[model samples]
Target: MSAAIRNYALVTGAYWGFTLTDGALRMLVLLHFHALGYSAFEIALLFILYEVAGIVTNLVGGWLAQARGLRFTLFAGLALQIASLTALSLTNPDWLPALSVAYVMGLQAASGVAKDLTKMSSKSAIKVLVPANADGALFRWVALLTGSKNALKGVGFFMGGALLSWLGFSGALLAMAAGLALTLIAVAISLGSAMAGPAGGIKPKFRDVFSRDRKINVLSAARLFLFGSRDIWFVVGLPVFLASELGWSHIEVGSYMALWVIGYGFIQAIAPKMLRAKTREPDGRTAQIWIAVLIAVSAAIAAAITHDIAPELAVLGGLLVFGIVFAINSSLHSYLILAYAEGDKVAMNVGFYYMSNAIGRLTGTVLSGVAYLYGGLVGCLVTSIAFLTLAWVISAALPSRSGASTQS
Candidate 1:
């Protein structure tokens, strides 16, 4: 394989491993702590630091990666994750509730920082490695990377439950740490003397990561609400509903969510062909249209629950449609960010975009518990609709075409 392809494989593989553990860690914490009688809001609080840290991590990690090289950021992220896992594994179940919460939140913050660092490194590499003039290749490659990463994350969700069952919480965490450690070692050895992506050589000022480009700024706004809409319902409401009302076991809830995410990822992988990006790339107009459709789907789900139809059937069926449609939206946004990114500062640009993403997740994560506690799934879906509406409004401002201020 060519050096570019080989390095891309290594970066993708490393992030795949990181994402697996990241997904599993989320499941393990949610399920284990909930089983320990943590309230939904309290459970949500545990993750607050995780999302909060991502906000800072993505913004700064991008600059660090650009200044120090992608390899530096990637390795630092991997090490931090391993440390976070190992530290969390030592949680003492007998501790006071407040103490336990504090401990886990601190570790989760570490994991969050690790996650953004690794993500910014891997994703920024794509624009650097893929030729800008290669018609349609960038979109296809981005879809594959993003889709496959989500698919593995779904598997990790299932694995989390399985591991928790087979080996208690501490055991499951340790196992994941061990596996990730091996992954880190492999990447470190294989990538010796090779740069994962071009580094700026000079440190970017903090303010420099903030993009002023209209297309990028507009797209970032749209992306914020787009992800917020998904997580507002997806994070706490869905699995909690499946478990509490549906009376499903932890494993069953995990498995169903795994299935949903797997299917979603599948659609994303094929989105390039499905959306006909080869014939014409998706633009701001496309994003607006798709978000509108998603709003309708979300509203239908909310209405079905309100009217007390076969609520489960309606939710399940409607969600399948939502996943397929959302995947297209997500895949489009993923490609657009890279397309709009200024070439010279790809890492910084990607970082700033994801900072907005982290903010949205923070909003959704908080609202997931609040909305679900008050109105259950219906409340969550309604809130999601509101977020999507905002996204559609914001996307209306996106440039209708695909030429960006690119750098080589």
Candidate 2:
């Protein structure tokens, strides 16, 4: 019933809507284009801009959020998504291949901007809305929001596939656009004007968008590798391995992936409880411990694949363990970014942190293809172990809970 809680709810709700559509759009584009006879690499090119655009969007979006408040950026993101969806719906089936690819990529770039802008806005809003005196509340809130968002995204993937089957591409896009428009209107009316300004009334300089805090910088570096570790195998290698080596059907592979994501989200939601977060706040030490565990798990999985020791069982069981540990690591990192952030500059700090995250994804995605082609799943797992080791080493520099304030 409190104003802060209400705003948090509003922001989370809007983000949920946006994430659902974002996931759906990705599936729609991939499946639709593949069905239209586009080569796999060409289809992948359509998403390259989406990832590339995120790097810039997070950097600039932070500054924009600081200047105009989280509300502005949130609205801008939703609006841009609506426009992007509508534009995609307008694509001409008869257009030349080059023209079509360029057009879709451009629209996907717009969607990327939309995704990051809304993400930064929603996440930054949490620091503003949560009372500073509430012990351990930040971690729980961040976990819930992030976990639920991922779960919904998995659902959206299914929804996208179903919609394409029922209504085709254009109809599905238009429907999603209309649904998002309504959510946008509802959010605009419910979230009050007080949410429309930067925290602490500070007029943040554009250059302030880059983080200066040593802890933040260290954490950012760790985050880059942490995500890269996941994507290196998760993106391409694992799926291909299941399909080709295990001889699984496409539906079976898709189902397993969707379930994995949903399960991972579930683990994330419960991470705070699993880690006894309420007993104490997490810090760099916490991240270091988790990353160390992840490194061991990654190495074990790679070894199993190399030795051909129950490879299927090893992959299935190892991945489950990896997912749980990684979720906790991810949840802790999310909280730390917000916890370490200066109140007035939370938007910019979150933006800068996520920029590193985007870069990690880009790196991992490209490496996933190359590694899988040359080294297969074992190679990808080896790369993941390397990335995790780097992340663990970098996390060693992070300040402890007692030292958190010194950096800020």
Candidate 3:
């Protein structure tokens, strides 16, 4: 294999390991806390720090990765996760509610930092590894990486639930920590020193973390609403709905969610083929068209729920359709950010893009609880539609095929 391919493989492998643990951590915390009698809002609060930390981490991590090296950031991320996992294993059952919440939140913040640093490093490395002239290679590669990561994350969710049943919370966390520690050691030894080094030896300034390109800025704004649309329902609303209204068990809930995400990732991996992206690169117009369709789908789902027309079937079927389209949208966004970034500033631009992504998640997470509390699933779906519409409006500013180019 070529050196570029080798580095890409190493970076992707490391990211997979991290994503698995990250998914499991989320499941473990949500389920464990819920079982301990925490309210839905309180459970949501547990993750607030995680999303908030991502905002700062992405902005700062972009600069750090550019100055230090992708390898440095990647290693730091893994180390921090390991530390967070170990700390979490020390949680005492006898602690006060406030104390426990504070402890877990602090640890989650560290994991958030770890997640974004590793993500920014791995994604930016692709810009360096893939040749600029390779037709459609960037899209395919990014989709594959993103898709596989999500698939593995879904598996991790299942694993988290199973481990909780078998080993309880502390044991499950310790096991993940041990596994990740081994993965970290392997990555440190295997990856080359220059895997994600600074481009052209130029020292990137902190201000460069924000993008100046109009396309990137518009796309980033669209991305913010696009993701918020998904999480507004996906995060708190859907899961709580499943448990409370549908009477689904924890295993059942986890399994269904895992299946959805796995299928979503599969679609993402094959999006290039499905969308015929090879013939012509997807652009702003492509995003707008897909999102418009998504808005219709979201509206239909919401309407079905409101009218009580086979609500269960509407939700399950609608989400399947939603996942497919959303996967394509996400894959396109991933490709576009990399496409728009200058080679010398790939890390910084990616970081900025993901900062917007984190903000979207934060917004949706907060609203998920509030919306659900007020109007249940119908409320959540309405909120999702609103966000999708905003995303569609923002996407109108994106350059069409004539102006956009995927070639970096």
Best-performing candidate as measured by TM-score: 2
How much lDDT does candidate 3 score?
0.88
- Rank all candidate structures by their lDDT, best first, as comma-separated numbers: 2, 3, 1
Best lDDT among the predictions, by candidate number: 2
225-245 per-residue lDDT for model 2 (tens digits): 999999999999999999999
- lDDT (tens digit, per residue) of candidate 1 on 169-189: 999999999999999999999
| Tens-digit lDDT track of model 3 for 48-72 | 8999999999999988888888888
List TM-scores for all candidates, in order. 0.93, 0.98, 0.95
Clashes of 3: 0
Whole-model Cα lDDT of every candidate shown, in order? 0.88, 0.91, 0.88
RMSD of each: 2.3, 1.5, 1.7
Taking all chains together, the TM-score of candidate 2 against the true structure is 0.98
RMSD of 2: 1.5
Clash totals for all candidate models: 1, 0, 0
